[model samples]
Target: MFNRRQLLGAGAALVSTAAWSKTANAGLPEAAIMETAATQPPLHPQSGPDYNPVVTLNGWTLPFRMNNGVKEFHLVAEPVEREVAEGMTAYLWGYNGQSPGPTIEAVEGDRIRIFVTNKLPEHTSVHWHGLILPSGMDGVSGLSHPGIPTGKTFVYEFDLVKSGTFMYHPHADEMVQMAMGMMGMFIVHPKDPNFRRVDRDFLIMLNAFDIDPGMYVPKVMTMLDFSLWGWNSRVFPGIDPLPIGKGERARIRVGNLTMTNHPIHMHGYDFAVTCTDGGWVKPEAQWPEVSIDIPVGAMRAFEFDAIYEGDWAIHCHKSHHTMNAMGHDVPTFVGADKRNLTKKIRNLQPEYMPMGTAGMADMGVMEMELPDNTIPMMTGWGPHGPLEMGGMFSVVKVREGLTPGDYSDPGWYQNPPGTQAYEWTGELPEPRKAADAQTQITPRPGSHNTAG
Candidate 1:
């Protein structure tokens, strides 16, 4: 009999396609595809929005607001277009048009008010992962309160009781919504003024996707499906490249919301783990580590002072996820090639010749047979077996002495040694003399105040 892990993995794999077919046949409406003709009237862009909202933390004011808000002031969830596979496009709900929404930055002891507005046809709520708060405000639809209804709004007010990086996502139909891209980062900074300042900071949330174009997808819960893809939302090399400069101290906030565990690896340096979902570890609890395992629905915060300068890759250490389909006997391409082969043969080709059937053979694509001599059976859950591969990966580059200003400043241009300079002028009016400027003053008591 197969073990439970194997079975769970297989079930998880099939959930996506199964859910898609079920939803389609049930006549559920299709989610609007990114960049496609609008299926419904577009919402009037958020009006008179506050692009910037102020949050007071530990008596310090920090800038915090949801992105993609009309004019940048409110939290707005909208549909976005993304390439799920070659020649395939899928629509995902995003904050400010990004799958993993904007990063909310705050210091410890800050009161945070997140105003979440639902734009989808369904009800949704925001869960503050790992943050200690009253259960009523936890954002679980049934457990916390009725979820925010479509076109309505809800406010999540909480305090940063601890300092660390956490995440936010929909608790209603989470497996489906999260896979569809309703998630973002939340960071609580330490109140200590003497904390080490890093040269740069970045947020990375690892998730997975089981999507086929033009269909509704569901969350894969069993381990069977979990094996096919590691991280649903591919971060490194899929969306944007992670950048680091040599000798720069980089702080990375990582969160894992996938179904399975991800043993994340960062090349070239062993960093210090400073915090977790619960908050900063005591001095005795701190330790040095290079790679860490992040569990589902948890967050981990670590700091790495770069020592080497190169493009170092970070990814899940699961053997199959690192290798494409584990050499499964699946076809690599579909459409024209598959059609031509089928036409030439006057019938369907070999079991593995059809598109989307690669990696399903009893013998591993590597030709390795099962130890028991039984033909390895393939299921319709995930891409292949529990050991399926290729998700949740990224890279970090560290270079020597390159400051943030070095890359962003217009006048101070620096190219790798021996590279030519590329210059461009910015379009902005030059500053005028103070004496030539017009001034308006509101009269009130003590109006005679002047700068020393």
Candidate 2:
């Protein structure tokens, strides 16, 4: 409740003139800001209906206060410095104190009041994506209401008609706003606490940034060829692992705000798609899947029982989408002869080295210096060795005895004796060649081999 605008007292500009705007200015609620990129503990409801809270991957949920019969919340749209990883950070437009703003969670059929303050230089508006509400509170800049001008506050009041995964983003100058990372998840838990319940619920937001290797800001005009793909604005190693206790039923909700689709793949479990932005799929309609492809601007929720225990890899299946910075323009050097090129280049720069002739796997382990504030294209290390992974990647740490509420890392997994893959040194055999002659048996005049 302590904001410079609120300090103005009676002089503070009231929200734009609408029927609902005439309601008593409750004085702007405090806009809570998170400073760290680490995932915070779930915000357990102190007084409302009982439902397991959602763990936002690398984010947090906004808190609300009970005002009369309605739940009141505040959101501030401003510029922020967000850590993309430990070493890299981005200057982005966001809500509260982070890019991809804090999630707003409430129960179905609950009447809520939201106060959105615009701190950016330009005017903005918030669209309650995929939520059923009055047309006037849709947050569209022109059609439904006027933009919230800079340094001004606006109010949106509506009832949560249904419960499902939803989103919030700017409707004014959408291209520029969204590209700057002005978005967040909106969750409406079912009023019935046991409805489609799970032991652990999680939220992930998929996004991408097109910053050059050392820059701090994204190129807003980039339509494709993004350099850094992210989950909740954080890349691999930076992304928090999903920890599940053995036999625990877990649900993960993913929202895609990026320009392209992401086929998210999990290593060990085949889960059922249980919900989407439209609503929860009936139990009979749910289907099993190992890789769920989330389309642009859509949401997906999947659940599985954590019967197996270990460190399971979870990431996007698109090869390039899982890579980090400075690769799209890098030419293919695999199977190429770089010896002559290396010799010639050494004449000018004596320390120049040849790489990637065999494969880019070397990039993962090579300590070749990178420019300030960037990550390798293919990076990460695991229990075995160099993981050769980057963007949109994280592990799902499933173990037998993890404490129900603890989200701490349990280190690496220790495979039992005889369970790990070992070197096969007992046999020597001739490498087989394909039946080349038989393969060409149907060849016509255009292609031929002498053998018959």
Candidate 3:
């Protein structure tokens, strides 16, 4: 155990070095030395390297080196600039120079050694949130193990006993750390290469932040009123689409670290909830679903065959979750009289404009002023018009003749002629009224009817 004074002193010394290794001291066996080979076994053997890479959008995959039979990964915990949207960047604490950290990929039954170095001003600890590990390695600060002091390195060596989708975040000062976007995905592949194989496997972390408009740091205290929602810490337009070949087995592992649950909805295909962090769901227990609601601190893996050849919608079903920086307290003025109010306000303030008077859908097309480094409430221009999409929204592009290894964006789908909705030019139909109907309203004997 380290006292506050000792921890502070030790932390200061460790931060000076780039990244302190456990082998700094002379106590390493020949077999345990790090491997320097450029090529190694793929994390997901079933799907080759190209197809198995998890599309993190603005994030990245954590790289590692093999040592004997064990894999070692170094994670640096520090404040990083994360672009939540194209123009919106937030100062968040994460691992290896990115927020929502980097995805840790491993194979089941592999001995793994992870070294986490804290670079933040305050102390922190990395809790392997859903991994089954020894009590000390569980990483609950003050409970299972002492929190890592600032600038200090801590080693966690354990065998990945199971294969599933898991997550990691700070257990010490969890609220503040997680709210500042400290989290990551940990994926363990099955030892058997053929087990649960998929052609395209991708992962994403559903996260939320409460950065006020024009600000760069998220409010760590706000819970329910998060203005920025995202998949993989990135908003739409900035979020990349998932590209896959037509007629391939697609698997998407989604993990949520947000304050609320997300009902992830997909269009043009029905997928099955085939697995969870706990384990794989048996075929007898698995059921087909178009939307899967991942609760807070949980993960769900959905699988389906991409038989369609087009760009399909994939996003959270909650209307607000697909928008950015919307005012929650703004009154509903859909049918309210705002003519007099708008005139008076515009007279006093030339730029004043009564908003939401007609409806919010118009806000998507309205050229309203927005704060700097912030996205519009509703945005994203599509092939047809404004997509009116923002956070937690992206497209899954499935096309013919796509190379299995090529995950590049194929651009918007070009609808075939006569397949898309078009304007009516040759038809003119008169509105039908009840007066044209044969049946007419008649007064009852005792009713006080005015149509005599």
lDDT of each: 0.52, 0.86, 0.77
What is residue 294's positional error in candidate 1, in angstroms? 0.7
Candidate order, lDDT descending = 2, 3, 1
Better of 1 and 2 by TM-score: 2
Q: How high is each candidate's TM-score?
A: 0.59, 0.91, 0.84
- Tens-digit per-residue lDDT, 1-38, candidate 2: 32322322311222212223345544566567788788
Best by lDDT: 2
- Superposed model 1: Cα runs more than 4 Å off: 1-73, 83-88, 213-232, 323-390, 405-452
Q: Across residues 174-276, which tens digit of lDDT does each residue of candidate 1 receive?
A: 7678767788777666666346456555556666654322343423443334322423343222323345566676676678777677787887789888778
For candidate 3, the TM-score is 0.84
Report the CA-based lDDT of candidate 1 relative to the real structure. 0.52
Q: List the residue pairs that clash in candidate 3.
A: none
After aligning candidate 3 to the native by TM-score, how far in Å is the CA of 161 from where it should be? 1.0
Top candidate, metric TM-score = 2
- Which segments of model 2 are wrong by more than 4 Å? 1-26, 428-432, 437-452
Superposed on all Cα atoms, the candidates' RMSDs to the truth, in angstroms, are 24.7, 6.4, 9.2
